[model samples]
Every structure is written in structure tokens, then in C-alpha cells.
Target: MAYFSVRNITKRYAAHTALSNVSIDVPEQSIFGLLGPNGAGKTSLIRIINQITGPDEGEVYFGNEKLAPHHVDRIGYLPEERGLYKKMKVGEQALYLAQLKGVSKADAMKKLKYWFEKFEIQAWWNKKVEELSKGMQQKVQFIVTIIHEPSLLIFDEPFSGFDPINVNLLKDEILNLRKNGATIIFSTHNMASVEELCDNIALINNSHKILEGSVKEIKKRFKTNTYSIDFDGFTGPVNPLLPGGFVLTEDKSDDDLRQVTVTLPATATQNELLNAFMPYVNIHAFREIIPTMNEIFIKTVHAAGNHSINS
Candidate 1:
């Protein structure tokens, strides 16, 4: 069974519909990417999961049981909008937040110390939050969020303010949390991060889920059967060898190597294309050009927009 499941959830604020019959399952100990453009109801679904607000219709399940008020303590949420008391001492604020998440003061302090040391921010513990740089403040908030070791973690743009080094540091920690059996729902606009970290993804568009699948499966499904080939010498009229169903998209030569990109018809297999090209050129390398997450996102959103307009 899925560790967390949002089942046919719908939310409305007066006349505005924020989410429309959205449903997704987060498997245990996996990194699930919650993706969408701004104002596409991603935050609405997240808020509902956090129990900051109730859904107008449908249900959420944690394991086999339905979600309840008491379940709030089991989740750790780091919102895109940072919220830390500027005037409060870093350690003091972290402890207070950790306690709110149900960790005892003593345990919170112990965990906080470990995290501070690991992040090399022990010197900043006594400093007021406002004294730290934006990235440092973000690190403090992140430490507070995970101190209690919640089962389900929701990170909405968690890497927003950090430099690349700190971003990698936090990513490593997130991966560690998953390794220790935590389920994560990561919401971000960074498609590269999604490709690197997410096991599964659900893409929302205009308050609805337009795409949902494992990252690999989704990419494969959206592939246009494109391939890239590199060859040497023997450059006879390359266009003649190209099958009727294949479209040559790009052709270039650098020194002795010739590179070409071909988009095949749906029915064409890689083997067939390879066989046809082998006789014309000394085949050096051949590879299918799978679509990137960014490409898929743009294509899907554009298609959805066109569908909406036509309908």
C-alpha cells in the first residue's frame, strides 16, 4: 500500500477552484516530485496535506488509515516562503519549532547540535536569525524541520536561497532521510533536480494533474523516437540512406566525425535505423535522444493550453 495517498481531492475557495479532483499516491521511502507552475494548485494540495486547511471534498490516507488532526505531528513541511523570527536566537527558535513538531526540548537540542556541527554553523547558534545570511537562515529552518524525524516530509522549493554547495549539502541530507525510511513530497520548478532526485512525479497544470508517472516512464512515454548518431568518413549522400519514415533533424560535421539527429516514425525500431545507416557510414556511436524533463514540461503544458483553447 502507498504510505501516503491523496484520493480524488478537490478544494475551492468561494468561487475559485484551487484543486480539481486531484489524486496521487506516494510510496513509502521514495522521493515523489510534486510539480506545477505557479498558482497551479500545488500549494493548495500541500496545505491540505499539512492540515493547515481542510479539503472541501475527498480524503487523504496515511497508510491504510485516514488522515486526522493528530497526524499533523507526523509531517515536516518547509514552505517556499521562509518563516523564522528575525529577532530570536537561532538555537532558541529551532528548539521551539522542534518542540512544536513534538520533539522534547532535550532531544531537539541534541539533534540541533548534531545538525549545526554537520552544517558547520555551530558558531551561529547564539546569533540572532537576522544576523545570518539568507542561506544560513535557510539552513537553520531546514534543521528545525527535520529535527523531529517526521515520517512524511514536504519540501516546497527547499533549495531556493542556498548557494550550489549548500544546495548539494541539503540534497545529500534529504537523500539520507529517504534512506532511513522517510517518504518525501518535493515540490519545485527545477526540472533538473526532479530528474536527479525524484523517483516518481505528478505534474499539475491549471489546477489539475495533467501528467503522472515514474520519472523514467514519463520520459519514455513522451519520447518522439528521436536518435543521435555519430559516424566517421564515408559520407555518401546521407539523405538517400534515410528511410521514408525518418526525419533528419540535425546534421553537422566536426573534423572527421559527422553527427546527425534523426526522428523516427513510431513504428520504426532502433535496430532498423542502425541497419540502414551502417552501410552508408562507419558507425561510431548511436543513441536514442530521450526528451529531458524540461522539454516534456514545456511540450505538455503547451499541448494542454492548446487543448483548452480548442475546446
Candidate 2:
């Protein structure tokens, strides 16, 4: 059974619908990407899951049981909007937030110390939150969010405001968390991160889910059956060598070597494509071209005709 499931969830505020019949099943110990453009109801669904807001219709399930108020303690959320007590000392505030998540003060301090050392921010323990840079404050917020070791984590744009080095640091930590049996719902506009971290994803646009599946499956589902070939030596007109239902989309040459991209008919196989081009070109390398998450996201959203930002 899915560890967490959102079932036909719908939400509306006045006349504006934020989400409509949206659903996704997140498997345990997997990184699930929650994706969409701004104002696409990604935040709305997230808020519902965190119990910050209630769904007007439909239900949320955790471990096959219906979600309840008490489930809040089992989930960790790091919002895109950073929140900290600006006047409070970093360690003091972190301990307070951890306690709110049900961790005792003593334990929170111990965990905070470990995280601070790991992040090389031990010097900032007594510093006021306002004294830290945006990135530093973000690290503290992240530490507080996960200190309780919640079973399920929801991070919305967690990498925002960090430098590349810190981003990689956090990325590694996230992977480690998953390795240690944490189920994650990662929401972000960063397609490269989604490709690298997500096992599965669901894309919402205009308050509707336009796509959802394992990352590999979704890419394969939208594949165009295109293949790129690099070859040398023999060169001739591709039109005559082409079999029925094959078209060369690109052909470029450098000296004796030439590279070509071919689109195969839906009914055709790679072997058939290879055989058709064998006589005209000395094939050096061939690889199937897979669409990237960015391409798929734009294509699907455009196809849905919900291109304008709602907010």
C-alpha cells in the first residue's frame, strides 16, 4: 500500500478553485516530486497534507488510515516562505520549534548540536536569527524541520537561497534521509533536481493534475522514438536509403564524420532503423534521445492550454 495517498482532493476559496479532484499515491521510502508552475495548487495540496488547511472535498490517507489532526507530528514541512523569530537566538528558536514538533528540549539541543556541527554553523548558535544571512537562516530552518525525525517530509523549494555548494550538501543529506527510511514529498520548480532526486512525480496545472507516474515511465510514455547516430567514412543521400516510415530530422557533418537524428515510425523497432541505415553510413555510435523533465513539463502544460499564471 502507498505510504501516503491524496484522493480526489478538491479545494475552493470563494469562486476560485485551487485544486480539483487531484490525487497521487506516494510510495514509502521514495522521493516523490510534486511539480507545477506557480499558482498551480501545489502549495494548496501541501497545506492540506500538513493540516494547515482542510480540503473541502476528498480525503488524505497515511499508511492506509485516514489522516487526522494527530498525524501532524509525523510529518515535517519546510515552506518556501522562510519563517524565523528574527530577534531570538538561533539555537533557542530551533529548540522551541523542535519541541512544537514533539521533540523534548534536551533531545532537540542534542540533535541541533549534531546538525550545527555537520553544517559547520556551531558559531551561530547564540547569534540572533536576523544576524545570519538568508542562506544560513535557511539551514537552521531545515535543521529544525527534520530534528524530530518525522517519518514523512515535505520540502517546498528547499534549495532556494543556497549557493551551489550548500545546495549539493542539502541534496546529499536528503538522499541520506531517504536511505534511512524517510518518505519525502519534494515540491520544486527545479527540473534538474527533480530528475536527479525523484522516483516518481505528479504535475499539476490550473488546479488539475496533468501528469503522474514514475519518472522513467513518464519519460518513456512521451518519447518520440527518435535516435541519434554518429558515423564516419561512407556518406550518401539518406532519402534513397530510408525505408518507409523513417525520416531524418537532422544531418550535420564535420570532415569525414557525420551525425544524424532519425525519427522512427511507431511500428518500427531500433533494429529495423539500424538495418535501414547500415548500407549508407558506417555507424560509430547510436543512442535513443529521451525527453528531459523540463521539456515534458512545458509540453504537457502547454498541451493542457493552461499556460498563464493564475497568481
Q: How high is the CA lDDT of each candidate model?
A: 0.91, 0.93
Q: Tens digit of lDDT per residue, candidate 2, span 164-231?
A: 99999999999999999999999999999999999999999999998999999999999999998898
- Which candidate tops lDDT? 2
* Pairs in steric clash, model 2: none
Worst 10 residues of 1 by lDDT: 302-311
Please identify model 2 stretches exceeding 4 Å from their true place: 234-236, 254-257, 306-311
lDDT of 1 by residue, 148-177 (tens): 888999999999978999999999999999
Candidate 1 residue 65 Cα shift, in angstroms, is 1.6
Residue pairs clashing in model 1 are none
